[model samples]
Target: MPWLARSRPLFPAALLTASWWGKVLEGGRAAPRNGRCVMAPVRAVVRLRRRVCLQRKRRVLGPPAGPEAAVAAGAPGPGGGSPGQPRFFTFDDPAALPARTPRKRRRRSRVVLYPDGARRCRPRAERRSSRAQRCLLLLVAIVGFQVLNAIENLDDNAQRYDLDGLEKALQRAVFGQPAAVARIVALLRDYLATHVHSRPLLLALLGPSGVGKSHVGRLLAGHFGAVLEDRSLVLQYHAGHHCPEARAVQLCGDELERSVADVVARAEAEEKTPLVLLDQVELMPGALLDRVLGLLQPQRPHPFQNAIYVLLSGAGGAEVTRFVLQNVTRAAPGETQDEAHAGPRAHQTDMELRAGLRALLAGAHPLWQAAAIVPFLLLDRHSVVSCFQEEMAGEGFFPEQARAERLAAQLSYYRVAGHEFAVTGCKQVVAKVNLL
Candidate 1:
C-alpha cells in the first residue's frame, strides 16, 4: 500500500473508496447504481480512469499494450521500479533487447596489389588512358631532339670552304701560264674529292727559290679551298729541343697532334674531307714522309676520307743533290761521266726529288699504273707579259716603264742569257725574260 501510495495519486484512490461506500449505502437504489442513479458518478470515474490507462499504455508500448503497456497501467514490478522500464544494455544476453546494431561503416575504396604483382589502383581503362598521355609526351620530346640535331648538321654542312677565294687568286696569279695552271688544277681536283676512295697525291716542284714554289703551293691550297700549314712550323714545334728522328715519338705528347687528330676526326665524322697544304715539307723526317706517303698510296683510302688533300711543297734542290751523290762516282781518272760535274749534280737533284715520290708509288703499282707522270716546268709568254704589264708594272713593284723601252731592254737581256744557257723553247723565253 505504501509502495502504491508512492506509485499512484492519492486522490484517485480516495475517490475509488468513496464510490465503494456509496455503492453499499445505496442498495435500495442498486438499479440506479448500474445506470442513471446514485452510483452513476462513481462508475463514470472508473470508466474515465480505464480510458486514461488504456491511452497511456498505447502511448508507452505500441498500440496493443505489451509489458511496457502494463507498466504504464501502474502494474507493480518485482525489482520495485515500473515494469518493462529500460536498464543497462548487455551484449552477452542475446535475448536482451536486440542489441541496437551499430550502423555498418561504409566500405572504403583502396588500392590493392593483385596476385600477379601489378598495382590495381584505378580501373584498367583509366590506367591505360593516363599512361598513353605520358608516352606520347616522351615520343614528342625524342622526335623534337632528332629534328633539331638534323637542322644543326645541315647548317654545319653549309659552312664555306673558301673555294671561290682560291680560284680567283689562282686565276690572277697564273693568268698566262695556262698549261702549268691546268696541270695543277687537275691535281687539285683529284686531291680535293670529298670521298674516301680517292687518295692524296704528291707535288714535287723542283726549282730555284725565286721560281715561285711558294706561289704554287699557295695557289694549289687556295684552289682546293684547303688550309695552308707551314711544314717548318710543325717541324719546329714537334722537334722542340729534341732531334728530328726522336721527334716522331714526341708528336703524341704534343697538344698539336691531338688538335690535328680532332680536326681530322671531325671531318671524317661529318663526311667532309679536309685538304692540308704543308709547305717546306722536305725538312720533315722520313717517318713523317712514310705516313704521308701511305696516304698518297693508291691502295689506301684518303686520310680523313672526305675532301682531303695533302700537298707537300719544298726545295727539291737538296733532294736532287743527295740522289746524284749516292748514284754517281767520281769520273774514272777524269774520264767523262754522263753528266760531268754540273750534269751529274743536276741529274742527281732530279733523281732525289723523284725517289721520295717513287717511294710513295712502290707498293701501290696497280693504282699508279694508269696515272700519268707529266713533268711541267714553264711560264707561258702571255702570262709573263700580263704579269709585267699588270702586276709588276702598275704596282711599281718594278720600275714603271714605256712599252717599247721595256720591250727593247727585255729583248737585249734575253739574247745575252739565252746565249749563256743556249736553251730554246720556253727556256729561251724565260732566260730572255730573266735577263730583263
Candidate 2:
C-alpha cells in the first residue's frame, strides 16, 4: 500500500524485499477473523509488488531483444517462451528490433599490374570515335559545289541584251562586213553584261562614205533606243549636222557638253545606260573632239563613265581602200569573201588592217588612241548586189535576184585581183532602190 502511494517503481528483488518487510512488520501470525488466513494478506502484498516491478522494467527499456538470440547462445531469459506458444512483442521479440539502414558503397578500380609497374586508370565515359577526315571531305564537297555554281552564274549576266537578235540584225543590215558585225556584237556582249565599267566604251567606225559605217551606227542606235525603250537616252551627234560651218566651235562644244551631261545624268538617275553616237566624227572640229575626249577620261564621274560613245568617221577611208586593192585576193564570183578572207591568213590581214588604221587615226586625233577602231573594209560587187536586193525589198519592191544583178551591174567597181570591189559600195543602193 505504501509503495502504491509513493508511486515509485522497483526491480523484482526490491519487490520481494518490500513484501518480506511487510510480513515482518505486520507479523503474518495474525489470528483469523472469519475463514481468512493471516498468510493471505502477505500473498496479496507480494502480488502487488511483483506487478509494480514489471511496469518499471517495461518503462526503462523499450520492447527488449529477441528470445531467439538468447536461445542461440544457450541462455534462458525471463520470458524466452517455448516455440509452440505464439510470440508477443517483448524484450525477446526479433521483429521488435530496429532495422538497420543500408549504406551506399563507393566503386574502386581494379589495380592493373605490369612486369615493370602498376597503374590506376580512372573509368571514362563512353564516346563515339572521331571521323575528322570524312567530315572534312563532306565540307570540301559542299564548298566546291557552291563555288562551281557561282562560277556558272557569272556567264548568265550577259543574257538580258538578247545578243542573238542584235547579232542577226547587224549581220542582215551591214553587208560585206561579217567580221565587223561579229566584233561589234562581241564588244557589246562583253560591255553590257555588267553595269560597272572603268571608262566609257569608245567605238570608232572608220571607213569611207559608201562602206556601211553610218548604216551600222543607225542600226545600233535604233536597236538600243528600242531596247532601252527611251529615245531620249540615245544621243545622236552628227558632226556635219550639229556643228555646221556657220556655228561657233566653242558654242558647239558647250552644247555638246550640256547634252551629254543631261543624257548621262538622266540615264544614271534611272539606273540605265545611254548610247552616244557621234556620226561623221572626222568632220567634227578638234575643239569638240577634245570636249568628247574629256568625257572619256577615266577620272570622270560614274554617270559620264557608264555611257557608250561611238564615232562614225570617214577619216581612214583611203588607207582602207588602198589596203583592200593591194593585199586582198580577187573575188571568184560566189566565193570572193570565203576565198580571200578565209583561214588564218585572212585573220592576220584583218588584224594588220585594223592596226594600221588605228595608227593612222591616232596621229590625226588623240581621241582615236583610246578608241576601239573597227575599220569598215570595201564592199565587193556581190555584197553590193545583196545591198541592192535588201534595199529593194525594204522599199516594197520585189527583190528579183536577176533584176538586182542587172541593177548592181550599173554601179562602177574597182576590178582587181579577179574581184570587182565596189567603188561606192551600197552607198548608191538606197538611191538606186528609190528609183526602182
- RMSD list, candidates in order: 21.6, 19.2
The lDDT values for all models are 0.44, 0.79
User: Which candidate number would show the highest lDDT if scored against the true structure?
Assistant: 2
| Model 2 Cα lDDT, one tens digit per residue, 243-276 | 9989999999999999999999999987777999
Q: Could you give candidate 1's per-residue lDDT for residues 188-230 as a string of tens digits?
A: 5544432444544444454323334556566555443444232
In model 1, the runs with Cα more than 4 Å from the true position are 1-168, 190-198, 201-206, 222-259, 294-303, 314-436
Q: Name every residue pair that clashes in candidate 1.
A: 176-383, 194-307, 273-306, 273-307, 274-308, 275-309, 320-348, 320-349, 324-348, 414-432
How many pairs collide in each candidate, listed in order? 10, 4
TM-score on alpha carbons, each prediction: 0.36, 0.66
Candidate 2 Cα outliers beyond 4 Å, as residue runs: 1-157, 330-334
